[model samples]
Target chain A: MKKRKLFILIEGVDDKRFFEKIIKPRISSVYCSINIDTSAQTGNEKIRRYVKSFHKMGADYIFVTDLDEKACITKKKNDIHRKFRVRQDNIIIVVKEIEGWYFAGLSGKDINKLGIRGIINANTITKEEFNRIIPKQYESRLAFLLEILENYNIRAGKRNNESFCYFMNKYVSP
Target chain B: MKINKLIVKNYKTFNNLNISLDQFNVIVGSNASGKSNFLSIFKFLKDISFSGLENAIQLHGGPEYIKNINTKGNKNLSIELNIDFDIQPRLVLSMKPDDQLKENERFEGLGMTFKELKYKFEISFNSSRKYKVINEDIKFKGDLSKLTVGESQKIKEDEFHKGSTITFSRDPSGKVTFKTGAIQHFIKSMKHTQLPILPMQFVKVKHTELFLLEKAQELGLSILPPIATTIQNISSYDFDCKASKTATPISVRNTLESDGSNLPIVLKRVLNNPDTKKQFYSLIRDCLPFIDSYKTRPLLDKSIMLEVKEIYQSQYLPSLLLSDGTISITAIIIALYFENNSLIILEEPERNVHPALVSKVIDFMKDVSETKQVIISTHNPEVVKYAGQENIVFISRNKKGNSIMTAPKNNEEIQVFLENELGIEELFIQNLLT
Candidate 1:
């Protein structure tokens, strides 16, 4: 088989770190290579042209967005297509927000250590919700996120969130 | 005094580059495009005036460190400045109180008049890392008023040039020339025994100091000292907030240090002045609203520390407890408002400052520029946006890796973007300014 090239467009630095740290290590294919960039790095207005150019270069591309206020994944994908004209298959929507994925990746012991006392549905958590629940020990939101990233359990992430499971099934798992 | 033009040759990232300047300037460039190098030129001139030529060279990392590696010719570096003065040189005012009358009489006796001065200095190095001043020149130009009969007779008897221009030049061979015969005669009559030793002059070097400022003073020219003083009055700063947070001794408050280590002492001095204190407090309230008031206290060790009182808290927070951004902002305000210099050069004034507060700093800088020339180098798009196209100088590199500088207003493409209502910051972020 010919070698495959892939380009993934993310919203900002946090998403770039998420893909680089979590998703990149799980890719076991010997015939494929991936490049990740953020809209912030390549200005937000120019991302459409960037995706189009990469597509013309015979590289597969993914445009990742958050299903923030949208009703469903289909509505969010349609909104992204209106701006970037990306294909439906290449649009990956994180449920509610990417912060949800950070929570989804934490083990039960990590959740208890964080002082949350109720049942957790990681898919529905927003950034504001995560900020409200962050323990008093961390000084900043970035500090809390960094701690979560340090102790992240990918197996728990796949088990807790359907969007993360679907992404792994499509891109990472054989 | 204002520097109207700069012509540099074989200096660091500049290889035969000439650029015009204004009272307010914002230099923007990509990383490693020589924005810092451009600002360093002013600091280098300042160093040369205060320290000697050899020490200035060593301060900039020795001879070989500054030579342009891309130059295809001999390793010779030169910088020339064309300066225009709004007021007369007032050389007597700067003299000692006792010698002011004598210096004023010396100026009156010379019958010298000039509105513009051009000074150039050049240096070359051999392969052994030894450097020598190869050339130095100063030319004065002014309007010629009608001369009295005695003055005309004096000019005629001395065989001096009749035009309004006076020229002074010295070469590496210790050959000095003057367009005016009387000044030439006066210089020759001075004792060469009092001349300081010219560094790196291993054998057969007759010239004393490499700088013409010292030579002019030694010759009692009464013209070059004030001009050199104008050039020496420039101060460049890249404030180090960490160093600034320490308590500084009260005795070292001559001027704010380049790293802002003496911020406390300077702040003490600033608060003592009622006019500057009012302005400082207003700016502090606008820039940092959380701080309600500030105080400076003296320790038994004769050191002073700065503290700020928060609106929500009753006690004042010491400098050690303050954040880096707070100290950085405070240092910038004091440097801009308190210190007086002919030119002020700041490198990344936005460093450690929040994005929202950067516009306030740039606004203050713009206001300060109206009184004194202000030049800054920044990577912040907010600076590019607020500085406007007319004040922005874009620096980029060509294929050979030589830095090229151009004003953004002169570029037609940028003008078109501006006409279409695109923000300058957008153009900068999209990499369209280059």
Candidate 2:
């Protein structure tokens, strides 16, 4: 069977890192090609053109964005629809931001290895909060992010964040 | 001095060629289409200055290889260069022991007040397998031969005769002559050795000699040494990553070799200077952001090695452990910052470099070209994109197998195509530009 081609629109470099290092391996067999556009959020005009072009080329695409400070998931989805003409079904909203997804994958033992403080809820963790909780032993934020990704626990990720679990159930199979 | 024009005849794949050059040039061509051969011309002149002509020819795979095989008869090779002096050169008087005292007492040296120079030379082989000079000339917009050092005060007060030609020629009979307006008086004042003529003893001047300019410098003539020195300063490189990884001896750190074997020592020189050191590290950050700092250490055997510290790593990684891309880029940066050549030729600078890093490297080369001439040969479209189509020189071959070069600035069709919003590389890859 010929595998389907899927394009994932991402906000920035951090999202690219998450998809490439953490999420790509689990969903590799589902798509013949998976192109993660890290700079998809650069402008609404470019994103609109990309969405239309990909649709015309007979390729499926999913737009992923953070629901930060929005009243609800519906408001975030509506915002993307108005800005880029993307459909609600095609938009996948993270609970707060992609940085929180890094924390969603950490197990109790993984947290111990990271030498960080206790986390109350991974889905509620914003980018700023994650920065504050990063261990001082790491020289750079990139180093800390890489260390977390190196030992990422996908099963724990689906169990911790509702949005993450929804995304995995719809797009990936265990 | 920057060479503004070059004319090559009966050399390699070039039957007859003339091209105008700008400060920055990016030459593109398929494999063996003459990009490297074009770059080798500058290297050939440089080699002729340091190692003599025969050795330079040997280094380039011998006389037969350099001469164009397509030439029917009298297989002679000729090169002509037109140089623009950024500033007028100050002439130094090299007088006889008896005249030295008179020069100091009576004359302060004069300047060769010219704005442009044209130097040309041709060579042919004799039956003995030795190269012989068939013709040579150096013409410039200055009159050095009109002034005699004995009457320097009078000559200085008198206005200089400008727009004159100094001609050095050798006929097919092997007779050499140096002629210009009022040159008889100038030749009368100088000794037999410094008369700008090859002596009877050197009648069979070996193939391993630059008979005109180098000989003038050797004989310490007042006008030609500075020009010869400028030609000798030309350097070209295709840096070898493996050579750069090895340790270099402490004594040989003067200039970065063509292969970049002495990169550690050259980098050390850059670090010693505060301004270049800052620029070097900042450029490195732009190219390889993960690298935080670098240092050099001496081996036990009086040699040195280079090591770099990654952004979050506590230990410094030796060059041997570093990636090929990292070392090659580092060597390029060192060459740009520390090497003091008037003209620098880089062959395939994009080799081993990731596509992400090409922009910074090209930008740096463009920036450096402001002070000196930079010529690069590459096949990468990203390089062509960043270098801009206006700076491109496209080389191809003809039915006769001779190389044909076309600069986009000189081609009307290429200019019209460049006006479009589409990238020039798109057209280049489609073979439309040809």
Candidate 3:
């Protein structure tokens, strides 16, 4: 039997790096038979425009985006589902922001190693607030964050960050 | 003959890449992305046949510079070409390491190994780097089972060769008849010491063969003539119209040089023919409406000067005084109109011309491509508008910095963008095509 081809389209470089480096290594063995590919759309609007075309080309897709100001995650996913003919389960919306998820995953020891001296809460932390804890560079803050995560060996998933782990196990797993 | 596919390995910027060729191909890419390297493959083959492998490699800055830096373990560079004729035949050439050459050898050239069983030839090199043919298997195409017992036995006996394949002599008494004309012509062409077999060489061969040519029409192999003609007719032009204005010494050259240094001489030949001159004038007028006529005059120094006349002016102005755009446009028109049924590769034809006239230049190129093959490397998006998405091949660098060639049909997102959202030029401008 042949496994179906899968393509995952993400919002920006940060989302792409997280999925490729962090989540993929953990679940790749389970879906080894399927051909999986990833591409970054650079913005939310580009993803919305290209998602339908990608689906028409006989590819199952997993779309990942950050819910910046949306009050409810379900509402954002439902909105995307209505606009495009994508399945509801295929869309993963990071709650509050992607940086919030990173902050949620970091422990006290990891924070000290990352050179942060203050206390931070994951649920309400904005991107700006996270940047204050660990200053983000102009080039790419997510890339810097990803490097910190790898260096500290801080695992990111359901146990560490609730939304990220839920999206991975629900949509990305075999 | 038409080339269907090319597979290159360990070549500069192309580490294991395969490209498909069409009648008309326009390669688009950023600088240093390997568009010029792709076209150089044809020139390289012609060079090997003309000057042998060693000189060709030397001309390209030696083996170390030509091989891809990213290649691991194997240093051998190989190129395989699939050509389409009545019967398809593939030609493979591999460049071996020079260390294999014997210590006693004086001439240390690049070691080349070639094989083509259909042509009954296998070429290798000795320690001295001199070319040697190890095998020459001459057999007819089609069904061998149809041959009689005597014919089959005769062919088997004739297949035994212990010397150079080029020296194979046919026995008159043998029952097996072979098509040897094309191969003979190829050998004769190779004997001439030149970097590339030019158009004049083909003309000389045709003139000499017209008298002794037996079997009248089909004496030679069917594929060789077309292949040789394509090679002879292959012309590349990087126009320098400013240089065209200066008086050039008289020369008996028929084809235009890579630089347009021989422009006046070639244009003089074109003007001598009534039909070609009329076509040339019309093409030039189409691109630049203000031009009235063109003529050449002999200078006191026994050189020739090109002069052009405007519609309102009575006196003719020297071609040097013409605008750069006009001179460039005229040179291109002359080349396209005069070089019939030949492959012409142009580099950046959009330079020094008005944006509006760029489409006209592309239209002329497309029109000529109906009878010939035209490959252009360009950065101008306007050329894409006229050439369309199917004719364009995007050359881009991968993550590893190696050049990757892709057509719109093979890239899903590009295909979608062309189908639903925007034209190819629009996508290119938006950086989506890459």
Candidate 4:
């Protein structure tokens, strides 16, 4: 069977970069010769058109957008369902901007280490001050955080923290 | 013509790859994979080298030819053939700056424009003449004479009239031109045929007689068991193949075209040439070790027939013999006697011959074709086993037609694969396990 292509849309370039460096590389471990093209900016009109174009390019659309007030403010377009509804099985929406959303994705031993504070946010900080939170390790910290979400299998879901952890240990957890 | 090297850039499966050939090189790949394409790449290079870019481009359809890549994701294409030694040289070529990546521009107007190369170890250019010749980094102006090596022969400055069929090289300063026929002959001589042997169906056998006969004699012959050796002279002079009618027989000869189509004529030719005939008979006697008399005669109007003396059922059967046995023996003899000065590719020589005789058949081909590079693509593991260590090319395929040919890393791998796997076709299954 011809493998379905994965199309990704992000809230910003940072999302695209993060997913490429963190998520995509991890996904590549399980797949081979697959289409995983990505675009960014969740609610922007330009990004919507880009999403439609990628769908035309044979992608099973995925939206890794932030679920903050900015996304809530943008008006919804009409063709969102007509184009994206083609393949329901491969569609996914990831809400990654809430304060505790990153840690809300963790559970078990993962939660014990990273604690309730969630991933220390750097979005509000200026470029120079952004390093103040993690201070030393960059990739290792990112890997540790994402490993939490992957462990729960809720990286693509918004409200699946406790329930997702239950589903994770049931189906996906090693 | 002997090729020196094939430099490929973003060409299909090969990304910036260059293959060097010394006399002979065998390429193996899985089904639907790209071995033939690689060979055709050589063909395309030959076509483009002499045909002028315009005609060659048109014949290939368009820039699409250059833009079609394999799994390596390289669609853009460029190839450089260091062919001065292969057929012609004394030249170099490159695209003009603006058209570096454009195909139509490369072939615009007065046809395809290839950078003209020169042999003099100096760089010179004439903007008015639309040329820039330089010391070979591999670059040059459009000088055609210094193309062939040694005594540069003059070619009648044809404007790629024959396209890849032939092209001449020249030296403008010295008014020298290289001959193009040598290359033409090489192109014409490629092996083209596929029956029980090769799955692909086109290989050309060049014309070489005396040398091939001597080689075949060295390979030895096969003597069949008396009763099993029967002849059916069915190719009659008046038998209309279209009408399915049977008549008398035609004469048999001693040489075979690549297809073995003119097998009868080959028998006749052997009879006519005393030295070759003696070699043919003596070798067959040595290998078979059976008391036999063989002769060929031309029938009245249009055909040939063969007469062979053999012991059958304690009696004798002459002229009327077993076709399968005869054909197998005849093919080996013809292969040895008729192929020379080039590579000989055999399909399956293991057809009707018994398993015991297979080694002899292989040995015959090896003796005859080895000196000139014999390449055989076979499915019979016995043939592979008999070929042993030095010669063998394993083939397999991936989802993409791009082929991956690894030189076994070591022969032990092949041995292990053989001892472990079912057949070559099933070897790829190990990849899934890996």
TM-score, ranked from best to worst: 1, 2, 3, 4
Show pairs that collide, candidate 2.
none
- How far residue A78's Cα lies from its native spot in candidate 1, in Å, is 18
Expressed as tens digits, the lDDT of each residue in B76-158 for candidate 2 is 78999998877665343223344554544454332345667788888886545567776666765664522335543464433
Reference-based lDDT, residue A174, model 4:
25
Q: Between the candidate structures 1 and 2, which one is better when assessed by TM-score?
A: 1
Which model scores highest in lDDT? 2
Query: Between the candidate structures 1 and 2, which one is better when assessed by lDDT?
Result: 2
DockQ-based CAPRI category assigned to the predicted complex of candidate 4: incorrect
Against the unseen true structure, what C-alpha lDDT does each candidate score? 0.75, 0.76, 0.60, 0.39
> What tens digits encode model 1's per-residue C-alpha lDDT throughout A60-145?
77888888889989988987888777888899998878888888998898889878778868999988888888889889988988
TM-score for all predictions?
0.64, 0.63, 0.58, 0.38
* Model 2 chain A lowest lDDT segment of ten: A38-47
Sort all candidates by lDDT, best to worst.
2, 1, 3, 4
Which ranges in model 4 have alpha carbons more than 4 Å from their true place? A1-174, B1-255, B285-291, B313-325, B351-353, B409-434
Runs in model 2 deviating more than 4 A are A1-174, B92-111, B126-130, B143-161, B182-208, B222-225
Tell me, per candidate, how large a share of the native contacts it keeps. 0.00, 0.00, 0.05, 0.00
In model 3, which runs have C-alpha deviations exceeding 4 angstroms? A1-49, A94-174, B5-20, B28-34, B64-229, B237-335, B347-359, B378-385, B392-434
lDDT of 4 by residue, B1-434 (tens): 33345566544454445554443233444445555455445434334334533344446554444433453332335455443222233221111233332443222111112232211111122223122222112222222211111223332232332232123122323222223333334323322111111111122211111111111122221110010011010011111111111112344333344445455566666767788778887767655656365555556777555555554444434334544555556656666555343434454545455666667767776676434444454455556546543454544443454444444424343344344322433333222111
The most accurate candidate by TM-score is: 1
Q: Please give the range of 10 consecutive residues that has the lowest summed lDDT in model 3 chain B.
A: B207-216
What is candidate 3's lDDT per residue for B1-434, written digit by digit as tens?
44556777777788877888777889888788888888776676555545545566667656665667776644446565544443333211111234643454322211111122222222333334343323322332221111112323341111211211211212222122334333334334323221121222122122111111121124333332333344446677777766766887886466776667767787888989999888888888888888888888888888888888999899899877888788778778777778653677787777778989998998998898776677888878888777878889988776577888888767776676555555688566444565
